[model samples]
Target chain A: MPATLRDVAERAQVSIRTVSNVMRGYTHVSDRTRTRVLAAVEELDYRPNPAARTLRTGRTGMLALIVPEIDVPYFSALARDVIAAAAELDFRVMIDQTGHDHERERELLTGDDREMLFDGVLFSPLVTQAELLEMNPSTRIPLVLLGEHDFDDRFDHVAIDNVRAAHDAVRHLLERGRTRIAAIGAQPQEQYATPQQRTAGYELALREAGIEPNPGHTRSAAHYSRADGYAAATELLRLDPRPDAILCFSDLLAMGAMRAVFDAGLTVPDDVAIVGIDDIEEGHYSRPTLTSVSLDTAFIAEHAVARIAARIEEPDLPPEQIVAPHALHVRESSGG
Target chain B: MPATLRDVAERAQVSIRTVSNVMRGYTHVSDRTRTRVLAAVEELDYRPNPAARTLRTGRTGMLALIVPEIDVPYFSALARDVIAAAAELDFRVMIDQTGHDHERERELLTGDDREMLFDGVLFSPLVTQAELLEMNPSTRIPLVLLGEHDFDDRFDHVAIDNVRAAHDAVRHLLERGRTRIAAIGAQPQEQYATPQQRTAGYELALREAGIEPNPGHTRSAAHYSRADGYAAATELLRLDPRPDAILCFSDLLAMGAMRAVFDAGLTVPDDVAIVGIDDIEEGHYSRPTLTSVSLDTAFIAEHAVARIAARIEEPDLPPEQIVAPHALHVRESSGG
Candidate 1:
């Protein structure tokens, strides 16, 4: 068994409180007493309890990551970037999965369990505004929100311009002379930020082009996954006047949509153009490659980590919004 | 500002230690005092310092995950599974990157900062066995190891039979009448358990079939990423006696190999048979699909969690070895 504080104290013929103070680097003790405690600690090979010390000092040097799910490549890759960023700052990432659950979303913000888990939390909430407002006063940790969501006056946020990026993607397709453009994304009424904003941009772009927004050209998926994207693309291809291009919410969705297009004996860009958001690594390897809006995950990760670290260090600072920019990455799939 | 223990204690007209004891669920306190403390806690909304509690009691309810890199799909997916499993048992996963650094590996075992950070550790060490053994004793927490080396008596292990699985994969290629088979993997001399074992199995199968284990038929890459696999496979294709079949170390590697084959104007399985291991989610969706040896990650997850919980609960039990079976999943690329 490992030696304890009491064992060290007993070996030094001192109180456990003195041993604790010595271990914690508290300098109030006499030099002789500190030396005695140190010698006994070395002799007994004592290890201090982190939880106990955290309860006393109010700082555990730990951070929690709350993502919708880790199984998704975008989120998983983002998580990898976030972890690497945190490591550079000598902080560790404790991952938590909300599974995109509404009740769990509330739990992430309002639960005492989260407050007790880490010094602070980095949350990507998928809750409604009303639900979010209800969780305001109960937050006990320094939190930095990711993804597109509005908070009244509560927490700091870091995100990209989804609506503008989406418009850029649609404009890219329009420039390629693809008029019958279809958008594949989340169900319109689902009320998530990225998908909703992207869909709105697609509609706005078509309106600006003097083309009527056809309900037939917009297909909603259950969620952002390969299978869901494939299903949505299949429906788009089955349209009487099939769209010539598709804008997907994510690269994974784009990959699946491309598969469905090929399954129907159609080629990318040449036959039907495709564009997606979140320039994930796999997008570069897909058959024709993928055209995407790059959010520069590295930049986002660094900013988010720095912001959270700063917030934890200076809790008195007012909440701020930091927006990371996106760039259009033209690739073979969009005939670039 | 949040309420402190001193505030609660003052409100309850009790000592700060009594308030702490009540918060920590110490039942020795009298009911009247406990009620007063509880009411004060409710009124003030006091949150105990987690760090101090950790210092007081050695339990942290946190586990460390040390991996080579998280960008790689296999490791990333495996990590997500590990995280999910840990979550089911109510433990948090704190991530650390070794970057395959031997010094980092050593530091991880003996780092002064980690003494109180975790109760146990789940390490995937990719270093030499000598280095592994040297660092084993310095680790204060109970450890569960996952690597591709031979098991030892010092720690618990979880692994699959990479050699036998590789043999099966190669034999499947041979059964399909592909005589000129190629092997693609990382440096076999690095002492990594899975890749080394797979290389050994390939050679043994070739020898048993009265075929010389030609060095020309083997291509070694630096890592197991698809990009690396593609480069190695492309080199193999340019050989004088080009291989008719190539067995890759991982599904991501197979994806790269397939890409190389397509770029070389060849079809999978029909012109050159291919197989990979780790049957990750991408395998099912990759173009032409991937034929590979499938390790039951979900089973490993369930078992690893159970074993870790058991070890944390009962550390006196002998170190256990858990072997997850591997199966040859015949898909489009393996003439299925």
Candidate 2:
């Protein structure tokens, strides 16, 4: 059998309570007793049970990271960074995927299913802020939102400036002498979501260039996936006066759009210069390579972890909003 | 404060033990008492703290899934399936990425960091069976192995027949009127690893076809990554009598190899045909869609979860090995 607290106490010739105090890192114990208890712990390999510790302190040293989908490249990459960052804070992360469903997000926030296992949550919700607000009042757990939608300072948030990033991508295409630019992956009706913010930037850039934003140029996919992007791009290619360039909300969409262009017997840049956000690794090795707006996931992850840790420690602290930096990577797809 | 067990008991006019028994789904209580306690639990919103319950019952309803890296397409897709399967069993999953390092795998197996938090572990180790056996004696926790390696019945395992799958891939290439096929992603020294098994299958198919496997036709990547595959394929292309076809260990590698072929001004399935294992989603959208050996991840995940759940329930049960199904998906990359 593995060594227990009693064994450590017996080995140290001290009370079990004293051993527990030392193990918990409480400074009340004298330095000599602490040293002896540490030695005994090392000798017996008596690891403290996290469940018992959680019962006493109400801290599980664990966090739940809720994403829309794990198979999605962006979310998978983000999860990798979050897990690494959480490890630095000595916390384990439990991943939960909601499939971008509003009801599932609500369950994660309000249901008792996972509440007892995690001390805090880092959520990237697909639902609107209003929907989140409906559940916010009942959320007893500490949560930090990651991504575009914010709950009006109701929770801490970390994300790239999607609007600005999109504006830059469109502006890059404009500077390249490509005027008839189409925007793909637009979710115009979903306020404050990724598509809305990015499409707004696309329009903002077009207006600045004195080009009227044609409703026909903005195409929305059924969802943010390569398959959806392929379908959307295929539809766009069938339109009269084909777009000279395409700006996508995500790298996956751009990739799919590029495939559609190829399938249509057209060359990228020569037929449709394409750019996308979230420069996932697959983009680097794509046939023509991909030009993308790269969000610094490491920076976002560090800030999110620090913010969630702070929120957990001080539950009443005022919410802080952080916007991570993004860079436009001009590559072959964008005719760079 | 959230409602507690005592509050539910008081509201229902029952003993706290009775409330606990009902919450635990113990059937000794009368149906009428069970109904009353459940109603009170619902009315008071009483959530039994999992930590407190774990302290008494030693079950966390949680599992640890340790993979080499979550960012990799295969692992990420596998993780998604695993999480879904575990959720159906009323368990949450904690993800741990070892970065495919032996030391990290050892730490995950023997380190106390997560030992106290999970009821069972589903580990896909990067280390060899010998290295794993070194740590097996110290692992008191229930463990199920995932992927190519087996621990000599020390634990349960679920995987596809890597050898048969690879043999079929090579045989498919040969039947396509393409000889002089080169294999990528060989890890010869790492016995029983996916690369080793797959390479063996490639050789087996070649031998069955009355062809001697040329040592020069086999190439090894430093790792199973797109970049490594690109580098390896680039080197292979420079050989005198360059390979007519290439087989890669993973879809990512094949994608990268395809990019290298394109960069060399070669047309896929014309200058060279390529096939990869692991039918990740990106393969569908590639310029020439990828042909691959598609492992049934859903089937593997279901079996792995069920096996782990059984192991957790009966730790001393004999180890069981299961081989899930796989299929060869012939697409444009292989001229199908």
Candidate 3:
């Protein structure tokens, strides 16, 4: 059997509370008492029960991150930042994949497994707005929503201004004298905010430039993967007078779109211009460096983690909505 | 305040023990009793206390994965697989990042913060052989080390045959008539096993091929990001007579190496050939595509989850080692 707190207390000839303080590294504990507990721990090999402490303190010093997929570079990079920040704060992160499954989303939100497993959750929800809002307040844990979900007043959220970010990317393309711009990526409505905002910006940019938006110029896919992007771009290129420029939702999708363009026997920037979002590391090394929207994933992660930790530490505080800015990374793909 | 189990029991017109059975979804509970208890739960929005249940059953019902970084595609993809497998088993995974920190690795073994927080741990140790040998057995509570490490007889482990996989990759390069093969992307000895073993295999292949190994042709990085691969490949290309081929430690690194080759006004397979390990998704999409070693991350994850669950459910069972086979995923980069 593993040595318990009681056993350590008995061995150290001290109260259980004293032993706990010493174990938790309390500064107030006298040197003599700390030494006695340390010696006892070495002698007995005491391992304190986390379950009991969690029950008593209502905190496990842990956080949970729910993402649609860890295999996706964007989400994976975000999670990496969150994990790094959490480690600095001495908090661990528990990961759950919803698989973009609605039932799984609900399960992650209200699952009994999380009641004591984590102190807070950072959710990147793919479910509908109504479904996310359906969580009962009593059962709801401390949560910080990530990614492009619309911010409601009920919960804390950290996101980017997708509209302006997209506008800037398109504006860059237009300024480069590429007018017949086509949007190629996942559908806007499928996701709550980010994609929709980007699409909206594309429309706004076209309208602002006195170029009427063509419904036929828009391309969408089930999700944002290289295969999906390639297929979407191939379909877009099949148009009679295919657009000279394309705006993609992500760098990964952009890579695929470029592949599709090359497959169709067209050169990038010279024959067709492309711009993408989420300036991933691959964008820089790709054949023609990808011109894309670069959001501070590190900043977003830090804000989300800090916000969740703040909410957990001080639940009475008002909910916060954090919006970090994004920048356009000009590379060869955009004729830079 | 949240509704308690006793409160639900009272509402259900049943004993607290009956409510416990219902919460546990115990099979022995009468149908009528289960229905009544469930109705009460719905009426009161009752959520079970996981901590209390964990204390009572001595099972946290949580699994943990300790990886060095989440940004690396291999680890992220591995985490995704583990999460998927654990989800199927109705378990949650707590993630801890060690950043290859030796102190944190030791802490993970001895930290009481982990006790009762997880039923078992999936540790991917980045420590050296001697450091691993020094681990106190008792501190390793239901631990399963993933990736290569000095496996103690008492601990369960899962790993691939790096030496054979690397040899296969290098041999493929050699067979393709590329004798001067440069190997890049090496981590510190205390950091990881895959790189170490792969490097060893590179030397062995040179020896086996009757080709003298050039120490200057081998390069290492502090980390496994594509940036490091790019840097190393740039240096390799600047050699008096650039190597005819490059074998990277990972596909991501190979992608960067290929980029460097292109940047040097060289063509892949035509002027220089390349090979990598961990055939990640990005490897398939790269311009020329990467020829690499592919391991079944999904299979490894499923097996790892089952092994940890078995250790938790049946503590008396002796620990076992699981070695999944790897294959060479032939693609255009290696002149295949």
Candidate 4:
């Protein structure tokens, strides 16, 4: 068993209370007692219990990484990087997923429902703008926001330029000489930054290339999942003057779209070219290698960890906005 | 701001030392002092610092789920389930990836290198039998091992029957009337339970069908990843009168095998039918839905969590071996 306070006290030939006082930095302890206790602690390899340490120092040395879903490839990759970065700073990360539950996010992020103390929180919620505003956190915890959110500079924010990423995906399709390009991943029910920004980028790219944006060309998906992508693409495939190309908001959606095209007895690029953002590894192994705008998840993870660490050290630091770089990967899916 | 002990002391008209004494259950404290402190604590909603709570009740209310790789879809999915199950039991889970480092696993699981206190460990290691035996964990921490590891019943073990799962996969392919079936993901270097049992099952199934298992037909993958799968499949394709069917140890290998077949201009099922284990979600969305033996990850998660909880309650409970059920999913990849 690991050494307890009694073990240290016994080794130091002092009372347990004296050892506790010295460990807690109490002024009542004499220098001789403190030195003896310290030596005994070292000799016994007695690490302070995190619970007592948290009480004495009010720091758990743990960080919370809250996301929409832990199983998502993008979020999982980001979590791995954050964990590595946190380890470098002598901190540990515990990840949790909101699963788009507003109450769960609110309780964990701000409310007292969560009893576990975190040094800082790196939150990536999938709530809409209205719900985001609704959850105006009133806690004094150090906080860093993750993912695409159009929040005013109130906290440290780390994300890629979703609009530009989407624009780049559509532009790649346009450059491939595809006029009728459709988008799948617009959340028309609310102002969610991810889909909203991507939709804006798609329209801007179309207008810049002298093509009028067709409202009917965009299909909204409730979730950026393969099933939703397949469902939306099935509808888009039936449109009059069907889109020759499709720009999906995520690689998962593009995978579903590829399946939809094949299901319709059409080939990718030749029949319906496709592109997506967030260059997940699945794209690399797909039958037709996927075309995607690779958002730097490692960069996002590193920056977010650094920001949270900084905030924990000095909460007065001004919130900074970090936009990770994104690049368009020309692959077989986009006829490149 | 949270209520401090000083606030409670001031409200209860007692010295901070006296308040501390009352909180720590010191025998010398007067009943009146204890009563006043308790009243003040209740009024202020003061949560005893976790450090003090830990000092008194050696519980951190946290569990660690250590896996070989957090990014693998199978592990990630399992992690999600474990986290959910942990949450339901009012315990939080922290995940860490071993990355197949024996020393790291040894240090974290056994040695004093890992300082973080977890109520128990849910370990899913990829270490070989020798390496596992070499690091005889000396720690008294409660541990529940995950995945296939044949050992004397000293630890709780939860996993699907690797041998049976692999047998079902090969049998399904045989039912499709394909002889000369190839196998991928064997680790000939060491006796790892997962691959060894899988290889045994593959051979058993083939032998039962009156076909001698070809030693050259079995390939070992250093990692059950796409690249490894692709490499193994590419070599398997080079054999004279190439195997008509291939049984991969995991879905990722099957995906890679499928890609290799496409790259060689050989169509799936027509030229090379494939099947894998671990019915990860990617299988559902892959070009030809992959045939796999679905391990009930949720069942495994719930059982592991429950077992750990039981062990935590009664450390002397006899170790229980949990075998989660598995089912063969016959999909397009197997010519279904």
For residues A1-336, write the lDDT of model 4, one tens digit per residue. 668878998999998666655654445567998899999988997756676566545578888888877887877888888877887897877778777776897778654324345778888866654565555433336778888758778667998888888888888788788999999999866657788888999999999999999999999988788888999999999998999999998888888899999998999989999898889989999978999999898898889988988877776688799999999889899887
Give DockQ per model, in order: 0.32, 0.34, 0.39, 0.31
Point out where model 3 deviates above 4 Å.
A1-48, A188-191, B1-48, B149-154, B187-192
For candidate 3, write residues B1-336 as lDDT tens digits: 667888898999988767765664445678998899999988997756776576556677789888888778898899999998998898888887788677988888666556557788888877755676576453445777887734656678888888888899889989989999999876655346678788888989989999988999999977777888889999999997889999998887888889998998999988889998899888777788789999888888988999998877766578787887899988889877
lDDT of 2 by residue, A65-133 (tens): 999899899988998999999999998899989986778888888765357578789889887778877
Worst 10 residues of 2 chain A by lDDT: A20-29
What is residue B43's positional error in candidate 3, in angstroms? 20
Candidate 2 per-residue lDDT over residues B204-267, each given as its tens digit: 9999998899999888876789998898899889988989999999998998899999998988
lDDT of 3: 0.81
TM-scores computed on chain B for all candidates: 0.84, 0.86, 0.84, 0.86
Q: What fraction of the genuine interface contacts, i.e. the true contacts, does candidate 4 reproduce? A: 0.46
Query: Model 3 misses residue A14 by how many Å?
Result: 13
For each candidate, give the interface RMSD after superposing the true interface residues on Cα: 6.8, 7.3, 6.6, 7.9
Q: Decide which is better by lDDT, 3 or 4.
A: 4
Candidate 3 chain B: 10-residue stretch with minimal lDDT: B132-141
TM-scores for the candidates: 0.87, 0.87, 0.87, 0.87
Interface RMSD of 4: 7.9
Distance from true location, Cα of A194 in model 1, Å:
1.1
